[model samples]
Target: MARGAASERDGSLSDGVRPGEEPADAAPPALAIEGLSKRFGDGAASVLAVDDVGLTVERGSIVGLLGPNGAGKTTLIKCTLGIVLPDSGSVRVFGADVTDGRRAAYANVDAMLEGARNDYWRLTVRENLRYFATIAGVDPDSVRGRHDRLLDRLELTAKADTPVRELSRGMKQKVSLASVLAGGAELVFLDEPTLGLDVESSRTLRRELRRLAREEGLTIVLSSHDMDVVEDVCDRVVMMANGRIVADDTVAALRSGAGDVVRVVSADVDDAVVATLRERFDVRGVETDLGAVERDGDRRDGGDRRGPTAVEVAAGGDALYDLMDALRAAGVTVEGIETVRPELEDVFVDLTGVEPGEGGSDEGGSGEGDLSDAAADSRGRSP
Candidate 1:
């Protein structure tokens, strides 16, 4: 919504035309990087944080940047934001090359990294918004209405005059996002934007982000460990591993490509049954319905009243039939069976060999260009 005034001032919105209405000579992508490579150190100790990566983000789209720690995600983001210089690559923002000048390239960009630390804790919420807007080369008075709307939407109007240090973590996180938007940035990067938010606040922020992208032609590159948020909000997901882009596609496409799993719920399933199934099929997990077992008085101390066990097996295509045969041979009575579509989290784990929310080494090479670097970068220019 803030971009309306910004477009008039700088023509950042597709060179004065609205989104999807660009002329034959349309503007370049909101952000683009080619042959991007970055490494820290040298010799045997060197770490290739980004390995010849290339990426493009279109305007008015929400793309999820997903990867586990040490997957080069943080390094890639820092390089894109100009916080970390790439060893070899070219970064272009809104048709302007970052090498030529970041002031022009990232003029309409902003970011929130490391949660609420991006904001000035001593400043009031409104003051922080105005301060960031001024630094972004926009008159705070010109976008006061936009700031008000952001505060209202994020439920921070009541705390507008309150010092950011006095607010709760979630509220301060909201302030950080509001400050990023206050400058009418057309492209934004948000890392863990909903890190400390409650359910209601998180939903509110997601709704607003979607509206901003759809209505204001804002482009977002979001990085988060929250798979549910990424699945719900992102139009496309780009996953990285070992400094390489392993998968990039829509959330639905990624899930579909991950192959379907079969879940069998059986009251007779036990360790022996699970082992047998594992021998025949790839058993993903075996979860016992503890509540159901308690209700049936099937505690271990009681009798052999085993409760229902849900066995998640990778039994797609012909494997399903063979799995059924195995179950029949085992004399197991299936209570229910259904095809389980892989979630984004499942796809992520399959591709990266890392569990969701798992943390690893600092991808920026010995923790270089981390949150502290991001904070310092955000203060000087568009993050």
Candidate 2:
């Protein structure tokens, strides 16, 4: 309630959801940030880590924050949690200024932030949970009632007596997460939560996340570079570049919305004709997945006369007709053409104006940044 008191009052803020659709008597937003900007250093030496970014998470939803490395995601999260102060911007949790850093806000929001620290290496897993519960102000009797439940769910019950130093890296990560929830939080932030996890542990966490979101109505903010995890877990995603939101929508919409991959399958045809057809097209990308002897099992004698080739095309836009005409003029025969939806990776690549695996922040970030040195120091050890 301290910094974001005016966010709701602005009346111009965008929720993306249609009007009158907000839940009746809904519990206040789990988190909100407006006109958020953060910078590091000063003058020419300064860099903007977050730039006028604003977003709101409704009462219960799984939201994903994604971007290339150094895209300001970590900075935004740190500021929102009041671990670091934004040079200019306001943060609110449940309609209260998060800047106040109230005990309620801290209790209501538990994050397995980047570089999340685990329990003391000398203590057992159970001991670690108890220690964190005490720090979060949880009553011993209350924690005792639910202790076994969480341990079992995380598959840590067997290691309850094992010292933290002896636990596997993934097990410790799970424990760090469990400790955050032991105090009871309505909203949770998981930054690269599955980074060090194996296939099975990752699956377990995914199931747990879905359960919490659907059954417990917990609002979750997840940040990760794992495309599969984000695609499967988030209800919606917000992508950032150069500290600004470049795209915000559902995974399905983003994928199908980008474009289609069209594949054309044809029978025996001339080599020169197919070459002419391909040369005339302005496709985004094209590839030939032809088999050893082509689809008709006709082996090319390595001569100039080539058989028909399937032209798999992408970017269903202009210049298609030109290719068709060229092929016809060159005496090429067409068999069939098909189209398929793009994948989530394709959508992200298109929206961010970057190719897969080569994406970078639209703009460099680094001015007036917030986040405590301690938290950041801890995040360095997350993976």
Candidate 3:
């Protein structure tokens, strides 16, 4: 996880959970930031991206801004939505001060960040959610039943009169998430909302972004390379790399410190059973090819290399039960053992040694033009 090994630890933001609701221990911070930083092209091609980061984000939580590929998570989500501009920080939204002159702290704050080009390609998913809910000034007769409940909770109310370039790219990412929740936004900011979608439209836009944070309390801030959609729709995962924030908690406390895994599978997993399972546990990645034991048991080079091989390690649950009695006392015939459980893509490839959309190519360059210049800096400001 090079890129300056995440400047040795500095992540903090905790009071998270709010899925089926229950979070009100002094509720405040629906996005506070602090000491944030950014840099980009100057001397020796500048490039610091974002560092000294801090975060808060409570109020109906969903937060998961993981990293990799210039780990600044789109420049800390374009510096917490003021659309990049943080040489030092203190953003604050629910406590106001969005760099003062604050349009009412972003008037509820909405964002879609260009996936499916944040719609309007010849409008009509109910006219691009009533013209971005009138450029997010809202009051479309007071959200018109919250814009038909955000197009029937992103099922897109039968494609709401279709045409944002004839839908599909997961129906223009649910009409760019119903044009950012048709301005009923209580903090949204969803950059790669299920990137290219399809796995039942990325599980129906992550179950309508967990029903917009469990029964409409809102506040979601998800960036994604889809670590299974940030381990099934994030309940707190922060991560980042190089430009700081090395790991914020909960995704079951970073998959409980990523310790237990132990898959096996063997047409006699060789190399002396991987040097006796790396002299007893903590190995990590290996795969061999009895034609990938049904396509994902691993192994890749020209497959069908006569039968089995796959060994993953990392133990510690009584050293994985004494590494299954030391791989059956070193005889190794186990054609498959289990107990893996530790994902968020193995804690984002062990805290960002590059793997989610790995250093580039999950669409086009400059991370989709830096999320279309932060969704054109929230067009005319504040949404």
Candidate 4:
């Protein structure tokens, strides 16, 4: 079994249910949102940020929330956190309803939204954790052991005393993650946690989050534009587009649904061979290497450089064999050839009609919309 395979027993404490009142074997889902819809503004200017969204997250599982910009990803998160009151919907954390602004259910929940925006810039790394811990009603002394372990796992122990203002962006991000975990929250929501992080820092954080979910039985909901993070860490992916969920499935299942992509590269390819190749397969694009460009001397004066060193095409399984035969018959220098299996990005593009980060304008951008107005919303509320 995987390290973080979800346990059948629920790990959260539901305030609405008393001990022995409910069935001992049945555990409520970590999160349940039904008929959730939210719109920004009104009249003709109104933008439907979320449209009748329904989702359920199992206990002790890692779920990825993915979407292109202005796809209501942020709005959905706000609605789930009680930051933005939904026009119509029901939100239940564990078993306690939070649909109406009752945030007491959030006692077992914590969020790391807007990257390190929640961290106090002037406070030391340790101080930031302590502050949030206290505010979350966690006893610092009781959690001291768990807190130290979190620091070591996240590699923030060395800079425990360093002021947040002086740390690198990656380090500050880790501090923010530690703060969320320090409170011993059963469920954590992370929005773009790896947005600005370097490769190494991002890798470390993913590992830590997975460990928390596996060993500590923590339920995590992670939202990010970084496909690699979602593919590597999440057990299931819920993809949103045009303010609605278009697909919900595991990463492998989604990838399996895309067409097989084949990449062919050759230095000896010429215009006739290229044309023949395109005719044989559903050509996506051809990329010219410097050598290929040099071969086409007529293109030296910035004319049409038709021949290329590499070509990517989509082909059926049997057609793929014919493509190979056609290339060899044309005496093309087949330097490299392989089937490029679909990745999470391919699935995302196929479902959303646009690539991640390429957003459709309804509402929300870098500096506009409710997401940009972080000040208007508190930890769980977005104005």
Q: Write the per-residue lDDT of candidate 2 for residues 1-383, one digit (tens) a residue.
A: 01111111111113333333554455567788899998877789666879999999876689999876557777888777766678898888878786665554555666675543545677888886776566555564566656677788888899989998898889888887777666556677887888789999999988888876765567899988788999989999998877889888999988877766666654444455455555655355433434433435555442444333566555366545655565577665665566777777767776666543354332243221223234534322222
- Score every model by TM-score: 0.89, 0.78, 0.33, 0.80
Best by lDDT: 1
Model 1 local distance difference test score: 0.82
Candidate with best TM-score: 1
Task: List residue ranges in candidate 4 displaced over 4 A.
Answer: 1-24, 265-281, 289-308, 321-336, 360-369, 372-377, 380-383
Ranking by lDDT: 1, 4, 3, 2
Candidate 4's TM-score: 0.80
Evaluate residue 293 in candidate 1 and report its C-alpha lDDT on the 0 to 100 scale: 33
Single out the weakest 10-residue window by summed lDDT for candidate 2. Answer: 1-10
* Model 3 per-residue lDDT tens digits across residues 151-215: 87667788788687876676787777777777566777887787767788788789878866776
**Which window of 10 residues has the lowest lDDT sum in candidate 3?**
1-10
Q: What is the C-alpha lDDT of each candidate?
A: 0.82, 0.67, 0.70, 0.76
How far is 135's C-alpha from truth in model 3 (Å)? 8.3
For residue 267, model 3's alpha carbon misses the true position, in angstroms, by: 4.5
| lDDT (10s digit) by residue, model 1, range 191-289 | 899999999999999999998888788899999999989998999999999899999999999999987799887777888999998777789988985
User: Worst ten-residue run, lDDT, model 1?
Assistant: 1-10
